[model samples]
Target: MGTPEVSRSPTKSPLTVSTSLTETVDGFHEFKIRSYSLTKGLGVGKFVASETFNVGDYTWAIYFYPDGKSPEDNSSYVSLFIALASEGADVRALFELTLVDQSGNGKHKVHSHFGRALESGPYTLKYRGSMW
Candidate 1:
């Protein structure tokens, strides 16, 4: 294989002490949906909204669909998304979603947007962005 090439960009140089910002979250909220299985009957591309919960200064909800969110998937996979309920633009945040296993074991499926190289730092949500 040929040697890999690395690109040096202006905006994305490297993280340094002076250009870093730290945020500490005291705690988090766990909103469990008991009847998650019942959503399977929902039509394709359909989703059910969870009760609104407060986190930090904004209200948020979890949108879950037993079928896939897009038509191309043909309902093979479940689609999940977090949406902003409150206002204010350019919201920067970190989030993690886990699917717990029911086999009486500790293993669980995890998906997250954190721990990745954020070119301009954490993602900036547009004013009331949907399907985040």
Candidate 2:
């Protein structure tokens, strides 16, 4: 008689995603938009300041939406509030609003700042937004 074969189960590993900045609008000054894995440090934590700008002119706004359907679908959205940095070395925290779906396959919008500054140098800013 033949011996019975043994069975084994496959192991699972952690998921790591790589995100990039899709767009940066250069209006009054320069604003940058960046995306990264929520598990990674890029999504949250202290923001390393780069340059200083006129506080009066330092105003920013962001708009976000899910990938599929519109408001009728009861998707998710986010809004960001930005301000000028008091110092070049100032560090800030970027907020990440959670969307209904864990997957970021939905469409989102970010309207604020400009691409000029982002294009000029390497810097990070504070971001505050929401999702539903």
Q: Estimate each model's TM-score.
A: 0.68, 0.21
Query: What is residue 3's positional error in candidate 2, in angstroms?
Result: 99
Global fold similarity of model 2 (TM-score): 0.21
The superposed Cα distance between candidate 2 and the true structure at residue 111, in angstroms, equals: 4.3
**What lDDT score goes with residue 37 in model 1?**
73
Q: Clashes per prediction? A: 0, 10
lDDT of 2 by residue, 35-93 (tens): 42332232222232223434333433323222222444332322333443333333232
Over 1-132, each residue of candidate 1 has an lDDT whose tens digit, in order, gives 999999967787587665667664533556565677787768778987778887777777888777888888688888777777778745676677666765559887766752454343555566674555
Candidate 1 accuracy as TM-score: 0.68
Please give the range of 10 consecutive residues that has the lowest summed lDDT in model 1: 114-123
Give the Å error, residue 93, model 1. 1.2
Clashing residue pairs for model 2:
25-114, 25-115, 26-114, 26-115, 30-114, 31-114, 63-109, 66-107, 67-106, 67-107
User: Where does model 1 exceed 4 Å of error?
Assistant: 1-27, 114-121
